[model samples]
Target: MDRIAFDIAHLLAGGLVLVSFMMIYQDRLYALLNVFALHAVLLSLSVSWQAYTQHAPHLYVTAAIALIFKAIVIPGVLHRIIRQMGIHREVEKVVGVGVTMLAGMGLVAMSIVLMLGLTEAADAFAREDLAFALSVVLLGLLMMVTRRNAVSQVVGFMSLENGLILAATGAKGMPLVVEISVAFSVLIAFIVIGVFLFRIRERFDTVDDVALEDYRGEVE
Candidate 1:
């Protein structure tokens, strides 16, 4: 409840939202991966700050998981995947960048207004974190929907999970079991996506999901 603690939490949460916008703005696959790595690093710092402020040792574990797995392992795997798949071109988008940016701004505005109105009695830091986390989640979803490439969509999904972690650590009494589950879930999802990437590339010879639309079989 200290003013300084509130300010720091707000700043970190706001950085997550800002990075979500950066992801939406990135066109190149490698650039988007770099931004996603930044996103994970911010999430780790935010969680560590939460641990320090809340005096929760378990959240530090969460922060380490974010730093180690998300920031280091996942991005490395993704870079390798891109290299192996020869998908070094600019990411194709289903919509224009300007329109997507407008939509992302609108999502942020909606999340702030909605979370603020709904959590009036919550702690100031929690209220701000929830608002920003919601914005990150929305922007991540927007990225997934707007990008035609599978790997970029995977990055969006990971970004969305980072928002969920921010929300969990911001609020009180999240079980370590749940945090572990979430981390493992992301790993499992990455594995599944990696397998699918290879399979899709083998069959379609491309990871751009848009191309699959033309090959869809007609319903009998």
Candidate 2:
């Protein structure tokens, strides 16, 4: 690949990682949801650039899917869910912001080291993309574990899926059918999770996982 293509891809992938960090750093549910939207937008742009550089037209459809469903539709739905649930206060964090940020930095470093070592035969763009993608995925998982709010956890899950799509598009010849299947599966998960969130709120009067734990303890 040319220098320009490589640099653009690097920039977009790095932006996704940055947005993932932003999501974890956010204390409010609305802020986290906004950052998640930005993450999806970055993922869509990165995939579009990948499609251009790789000369794969099918990947454009994947980009569209990310842009439409993830960036716009999903975030909009999440905003409404939070509104209906009346959860506009700051979300409870299992870890401090400083600790979570330090952990995220460590995850990014580990991903870079691991991907570079394992993907020695891959091209520079692919290697870098995979590294950033893994970083985003790890950060998403970290966010999910460190946030007590159910809505925030859903955002984390969606961000993790963004990373998976990034890695898939970065590698050559990922089947469009598989990408479609993954997208649909995510949509299904979103629907299920949304329903579950409302149910949790209805039962416990709060959308925090701790309520579920308490209920389980009582049942036991």
Candidate 3:
């Protein structure tokens, strides 16, 4: 039963990572936010399951934070921001969706290889969990770089942080860093992102970073 719980948690975490990749392909503002909310839900479930399987109640607090902050509050704020900003149209994509997905896959492969080497001779469960976490992190970075939209970049960074939380939970004897830091980091990020989004809207009437490039004082 423990193994079954572990496998279920693994599946949930992997699903969240896959959803993170999908966020890269989204071109609609509302849909992108919805996808992020779904990803958060998956993250909460995964962490809760990890807490259950490992008998680590500390992780349950992490899961609650994810569910409340990421899944509910963040999305609520973003939705209001979008509605008030009048950015209901489709978002701007710097690259074709297919290319972004391919890059995401490459990142996943690289993460797996690096994790396999770094966690060599480690426990089997730790090895696999860390690999997935790294993949989610790298793919999140890929999304941030490839997508030229402010909201999507925020989503990407959140996904990266989610991966870090996952890795922290998987590591043996890990402390409260995941539980505590996530709240602090997310709170800070939300405030910064809120200000940035408002500025983006004020500058271009939209949150598309590509459009904001026109205001860059540097000529290249």
On lDDT, the leading prediction is: 1
The reply for model 3, stretches above 4 Å from the true place, is: 183-193, 196-198, 202-220
Q: Tens digit of lDDT per residue, candidate 1, span 55-134?
A: 88888887888888788887887777777777645888888999999999999999999998974588676787899989
State each model's C-alpha RMSD to the native: 3.1, 3.2, 3.5
Per-residue error for 135 in candidate 2, Å, reads 0.2
Worst 10 residues of 2 by lDDT: 198-207
Q: Provide the TM-score for each candidate, comma-separated.
A: 0.88, 0.87, 0.85
- Candidate-wise lDDT, in order: 0.81, 0.80, 0.77
Measured with C-alpha atoms, the lDDT of residue 18 in candidate 2 is 86
Predicted candidate 2 versus true structure: per-residue lDDT over 125-161, tens digit per residue: 7888899999989998998788777677677888887
**Model 3 C-alpha lDDT per residue in residues 1-220, reported as the tens digit of each score:** 3678668867987897789887887888788888988988888888888887778887888888889988888878878777777654576666789988888888889888887887456887788789899998888887777765566667778888888888877876688756565776667466647655556552233335565566774435
lDDT score of residue 73 within candidate 1: 80
- Model 2 misplaced stretches (Cα beyond 4 Å): 176-189, 196-198, 202-214, 217-220
Q: Which ranking of candidates, highest TM-score first?
A: 1, 2, 3
